[model samples]
Target: MSDLKTEADSLNRAGIKLSYAADPLNHPLADFKSASHDLSAFGVLGSLLKATGEVREGMTELADVVTALHDEWQAEGKAMLDVGKVLDQVDRLLQESLARKHG
Candidate 1:
């Protein structure tokens, strides 16, 4: 698979573990809305990595996801910035991680 897809897979797996550890049953947002929602295979892996502290290693994965999603939006020559709400979630997750890490 492409690097983005690989990273996405990793993030989905890790995110699930993190959610479970954080008490998904109580935290409504972090937990995927659907039981079959395979978050580890999620497209916004980079943001999820940052949100889950995986960014400390490096930002390659996050950048890849962002770029791929960005490309997807522009593939049809639409030049759009947002696609499938991935960018929105990535922004929020990254900001939250920054606050928790440095602030």
Candidate 2:
């Protein structure tokens, strides 16, 4: 059991490190989304730890809720970025077509 717990902790730490590896290109909200999802496992581990009295530390129930919100907001932000890019391309194309027609 101790070995299992140790491995779990190592994996959790690894996940956190991996999340930040893309810091150059990733949005802050993307990191928030990744962190929320990664740390969510604590929601389950929190109960188990309390039941076993392994440690008095654990995540709050609100963590999961916040994570859910982050996920939704990240998706929305990505969609908006995509829409903005497409709109810019379309506007450029229209301008080019009008210029060609008149000139």
Candidate 3:
């Protein structure tokens, strides 16, 4: 139905936007990792550096999860679109067959 198609379109668009948003996180994550490494060279901030490392690890994990979710949503959207197309075709065929029988 049109509702299914609409939902599929919405998911696809949202996935695209999510991809764009996740992309910016990569740059910042890289920068944070680099900064964390740079902070490690200083001896006085040992405890702070450890905390930074942990935070960086957590950020990396979060980014990975977000990227994975984006991929899943995109795949789901494509699958939904495919299902909608198949259903539409079947409906059309049924309608045609009925018309032929009635005519």
Q: For this target, which candidate reaches the highest TM-score against the unseen true structure?
A: 3
User: lDDT of all the models against the reference?
Assistant: 0.44, 0.51, 0.62
lDDT of 2 at 82: 55
Q: What is the per-residue lDDT of model 1 for residues 35-101, given as tens digits with 9 covering 90 to 100?
A: 2244354346665654444432334454445445545533432212223235446656777887899
In terms of lDDT, the poorest run of 10 residues in model 1 is: 76-85
lDDT (tens digit, per residue) of candidate 3 on 34-88: 6645544444676676677676677667756766875776566566556656666
> Against the correct fold, how does model 3 do in TM-score?
0.60
Which model scores highest in lDDT?
3
Q: Give the TM-score of each candidate.
A: 0.23, 0.43, 0.60
Per-candidate total of colliding backbone pairs: 3, 0, 0
lDDT at 55, model 1: 34
- Candidate 2, residue 35: lDDT: 56
Clashing pairs in 1: 12-39, 12-40, 13-40
Model 1 regions more than 4 Å off: 22-103
**TM-score, cand. 1:** 0.23
Q: Give the CA lDDT, 0 to 100, for residue 59 in model 1.
A: 47
Instruction: Give the candidate order by descending TM-score.
Output: 3, 2, 1
